[model samples]
Target: MLSTSLRVAILIGIIVYYFILIMLLRQKRLTLKYTLLWLFSGLMMLILSVFPQLLNGITRLLGIQLQSNALFAILFFCTMIILMSLTSIISKQNEAIKQLVQYTALLEKRVREIESCGD
Candidate 1:
């Protein structure tokens, strides 16, 4: 069980985090698709903080020995998921960039050939 003070602190921190995410979204620094994961994370944390019993139940269901350990495990899992999503996005963007570069080179070569013919 978390102390009242600790729970309050966590709640406050989550609120601040939500505000920051919203601010970034409003500024166009983060797109809605990417923000959804973070928002969902914040919502989960909010639910856990509000209902400590839920965390306890989850910990027991996962066969975790300690609540703290459970929290760490969950955090690590979420981090891994987010990292994988980012890696996939980066790979796709890289492939698109490569294709764009290749097309640009071909176009440039054609332009050069036309210039030589006109000369």
Candidate 2:
């Protein structure tokens, strides 16, 4: 078992690294708003990862002591749902970019033809 101090230090390290990752995404010199979104997401993930017990904190507060196993199952389902949503969004973006690329290529080919004919 790790000492309490060590555990706290590790948690702090993880939080710092997660925040750094969000900052790196904004290294593209984009606005800070986008960076904040990433940072918030990171914080959410850290909360779920470090102290998953907080997920069930509500049950105890409500005076119903549910089994921890059930809490774990619920958390797992929540994580899966979030991941699926992300995947769906990514797929839609990919399809949109693919269509844009095809349109650009077709326009470029037409431009090339017009230039050749003008020669």
Question: Local error of candidate 1 at 62, Å?
Answer: 3.4
What TM-scores do the predictions have?
0.88, 0.49
Q: Which parts of model 2 are misplaced by more than 4 Å?
A: 1-66
The TM-score of predicted model 2 comes to 0.49
lDDT of each: 0.83, 0.62
**Cα lDDT for residue 83, candidate 2:** 73
Give the alpha carbon lDDT tens digit for every residue of 1-119 in model 1: 65678779879999999999999999999999977878887887788778877778877798887665766577677778888888988999999999999999999999999999998
What tens digits encode model 2's per-residue C-alpha lDDT throughout 61-91? Answer: 6554553444445546656665776687789
Model 2: number of backbone collisions: 0
Best by TM-score, which number?
Answer: 1
Q: Any idea what lDDT model 1 has?
A: 0.83
The best candidate by lDDT is: 1
